[model samples]
Target: MIWEIVLFVSILYLINIVLLTIIVFKGPTIGDQVLAIDGITYGSIVLLILFSVYFKEPILTVVAIPLALWVYALDIYVSKYLERGDLGA
Candidate 1:
């Protein structure tokens, strides 16, 4: 039962990755590409958490928090750069 759930979630994550890759490469605009990259980062975070559960290693789960924070920072930095053409305000 639990194994089935894990398999299902893993499949979904793979599908998400494929779709995001398509969007990242063929998006109509830079904003669309950036959004797709952000989506990929979030999907990676979810995968990390899922892997931690499947492996029964609580310590592995700790990595996802910092990864999430880093992705958030990246989104902010990119948005700022796009809006102002500079990273520094």
Candidate 2:
């Protein structure tokens, strides 16, 4: 049933979270940690949408999109900072 699918996806997401958590804490370098945080952000976004679908909550869907975008913007800013010395011209 639909619950089975949701359960499966939730388990996978949980595993992803665990791995990302380890990388975020013990990653060898800053770039690796940043990428791991990005992955965690994206995974949480997907998990949010999935739960919204399961619960039939439109508000959660609405919330997830903006959070995802914000995470994306932060990721870009961080990557730029990592690549270049400054965020300004």
Candidate 3:
């Protein structure tokens, strides 16, 4: 039962990623594109975690945490660059 639920949710995340990819490409502004990218990354993390649970592979869950941090760092640097015209790092 739980396995089925995980599979279903993973499928939902996959669909979400596809839609977010379209939004990333067609967004009218950079802010919208960045937001879509963030969404895509988060969805990917969820999928990774789900797959980790479904497959009993702990490494994918480990990978997801650093990926989440990377996404956060990307958000910070992009915001800094947009505001200050430079990453300063």
Clashing pairs in 2: none
- lDDT (Cα, tens digit) per residue for candidate 3, span 1-89: 99999999999999999999999999999889989999999999999999999999887688887888998898898899989997775
Say which prediction, candidate 1 or candidate 2, comes out ahead on TM-score: 1
- Candidate 2 per-residue C-alpha lDDT over 4-54 given as tens digits, one digit per residue, 9 for 90 to 100: 898689779979989999998998998888788889988888888889888
TM-score for each predicted model, relative to the true structure: 0.88, 0.86, 0.92
**Which one wins by lDDT: 2 or 3?**
3
Candidate 1: what lDDT? 0.86
> Candidate 1 residues 12-65, lDDT tens each?
997898899999999899889878888887887888788888888889988988
Decide which is better by TM-score, 2 or 3. 3
The TM-score, computed over Cα atoms with residue i paired to residue i, of candidate 1 is: 0.88
Off by over 4 Å in 1: none
Please give the CA lDDT of all the candidate structures: 0.86, 0.85, 0.92
Q: For each candidate in turn, give its C-alpha RMSD to the true structure in angstroms.
A: 1.3, 1.4, 1.3
